[model samples]
Target: MSDHERKQLEDFLAAIEPNIAGYNYSTFSYLAQKKGNVFELAQGRLVLQGVPATSESKHFESPNLKVGFLHLHELKTSVKQFIESLLTGKLLTPHGELRFAPEKDRSHSIYFNPFHAEGVPFQNRQAFQYRQMQLHIRGDRRERLDSLSLDWELKAGPIPFEGVQELCAEFGVGQIDGDSSTVEIVAFSVAAIGGESSVTGTKAKLVINLVDGLEREKASIGYRLIERNAVVKRGILSGDALTWENATNFQRGVAELEVTGGAVLHCVASHGGRAQHHYWVADPATAQNPFRAIHQAFDKNLDVLQELVTKAQTKGANARDLEIAVAWLLWMLGFSTTHIGGTPKTSDAPDLIAATPFGHLVVVECTTGILKEDSKLSHLFQRAEKIRQTLISCGNQHLRVLPVIVTTKTRDEVKSELDQAHKNGALVATIEDFPQLINRTLLVPNAERLYTEAEENLKRLQNPSPFDVSGTKTNLLQ
Candidate 1:
């Protein structure tokens, strides 16, 4: 960083030190590994290497490919199987090494249904040329944030092109067509998405890695961190609801930390007001409750939002500028993970979930335009109350669902609505007063200020320089 950049960062840190401390935090990103290799945890130690493909798939790479990933829908499907196994008193694997994909050779990118007996590795380039399905993941999403490109093919017989189509659609790819080469074919269309779950106590990330036609390797890394426990990562949601399975807990935590590191690089972080004094980042041992990290981050967003509203030199801004500036704090809270609870029909989706350590859910929302002291702020309370009631009527009200009414107005005015709501029984919180979050104490220096000032400067930067007749000219948009 240049002197100017360094100075700016220092200024940012100095500005938002207060709000972070209350959130009670200590820790930073904690993930590591290499690409094109396989990783599994046996005893708190990471097993990283290339998973050899089945003999039939080995020639091209591996005959069969197995990738251990987290999928909410898939989990639901496995829920019944899990219950059946338990009831039958089936022998349980001593080590909770859950297999998510087909067992295949390391090089084989193609994935087949694991329901049937396994096959042998490939012996010819034909498999490489004819693809069955190529899995493009947020590159090493568990440990590395960078997205990657991987392809798998079928050579033993005519490719099941339809199954390939089905898989392609899942990644937003249109279809495939055989090229001049007999074995090689190409698919069209692809996209990706990513975020972090600060609310889901499980904190398992969702990796969506496709966008438009171009694919950015580490597409989207997301997790739901909604737990209140000594070791936040240890309370992950797996095996069953209301319970956490010690399923490669250590390895999974490491991968999640790795993925978060990669994803946060694309975002930013910061806090302010009485909350920074106790924030921890260097040594995690002295950190606050890890489970509730995301919730506290969400609360701190109000502080950042207040700062942004105050920093606004002008009374008005471009619509996009206003939206981007206010939303900055919400996203910074690391609300990347998408939470799934309701069935396919009649279920509502919360903008955020404040979860308990044992998979309990809390709903929170942040809305713009609630100027401090504005009478409309009262309406926010009504909205929150209604949301709470809706959840209650659905029988989920038994859980502590804290709905918040967030705005970017100054504290003097916001405090009124907050006070009124507090008196009326709303779980009111400000982004400025959230507790320290262990997972994001030092997410990025001066993140709140950096993101705020960056957006402001970015807006003004649109003013173009004079046509450069004598100096180097550049077009950065492309």
Candidate 2:
């Protein structure tokens, strides 16, 4: 490749990175303890986790720094907005713009944008021209700059502990105490199937780990008897270990049944204040495949799926895995799914294209980050509309294309600026409603209904529910 082409490729790759810089930035921990209703925060030192200890010396701490309680309300909304701006590459702030600096651990840290500093000469200041290029090597032929300017680099700063302290004082939010609060940090992992389950035509044995102290609740065991690519029978069954009162720790549940063919089991147990699901396939060949676990394990394990979805933007491999998982999710919901984002590089089309046999089409774009300035919603909308136009030209008048953006961010965050997204007939699936969608898919497994619900959700956002002024009864002639 020519030097210019190589540089162009590098710029394109950087632009698509979740964080142009600071991809390896480390996070610090602070002391915090729950005291009654509030958490008492204390000064905490930063430590290297994956990075080496030698890099710690490069971090300079401001003198006389102390920690304070985590005030219930300390301009949290503003802080969130600031963080969102940084994540979205908007580079809007009262202070200088931020830039990525190299750390000793071969990682990057955020600092004030050095190129735009006041003392730097205008001509000498380095500028990275973000020209349009093929995000993926092949897929789309023409390359043109997108409407939004996504040229801002990633940024970071020192532990904002003292900064938060100063802000609290300035805003009269609270006072900082030199005394640190006592806190304990624990790494909690979700319950899983620790022991191997025996699967036969007559019965299946399931062993699961339940939380130590949490109350054990009811278990929902449902199965589908598949024969010749058809579900001959489907029903719920019960077992002893399905309930913890009868057994302890890793309990084994024996599901008694008589079947002549392979069966698919869906076992959900309620424990640790959450529902844990495990899938078992009867065929040994199916179990032997490497991706069988990812296909089945990740289906019901929403927690791990959520983490992978959240990291999709940052990690290329995670993005591919997320696409596969999403496609599997759609398939589970009875939709003919296509994972189009499996290209070696980023693709031009949406991540997934799914359709119900009845001509109900959905184009989905998945992201765990903010969808504000440099969002893919617009791109998705355009693609969906283009598909609709093409289908119409092909004389498929009954077909409908619904654009949906699935994000791991909460509903409130995605709802902050919904007018534009709703304006383009796009529905957002936030983290809050994502689990509901998954559970509903598993329980119902109706693609037609899901598409209808997606359309209704978009319509509801467009119209919204009417507000009542008063509770007074109005007389007909009053």
Give the runs in model 1 whose Cα sits over 4 Å from its true position: 1-314, 317-376, 434-478
lDDT accuracy of residue 83 in candidate 2: 31
Give the Å error, residue 455, model 1.
33
lDDT winner: 2
Model 2, 415-441: lDDT tens digits are 565677777777766544433344333
Q: Estimate each model's TM-score.
A: 0.24, 0.43
State the lDDT of candidate 1 residue by residue for 52-106, as single tens digits. 1121111011223221222212233232243233223221222123222211321
Q: For model 1, how big is the CA root-mean-square deviation?
A: 24.9
Let me know the TM-score candidate 1 reaches against the reference structure: 0.24
Error of 1 at 385 (Å): 3.4
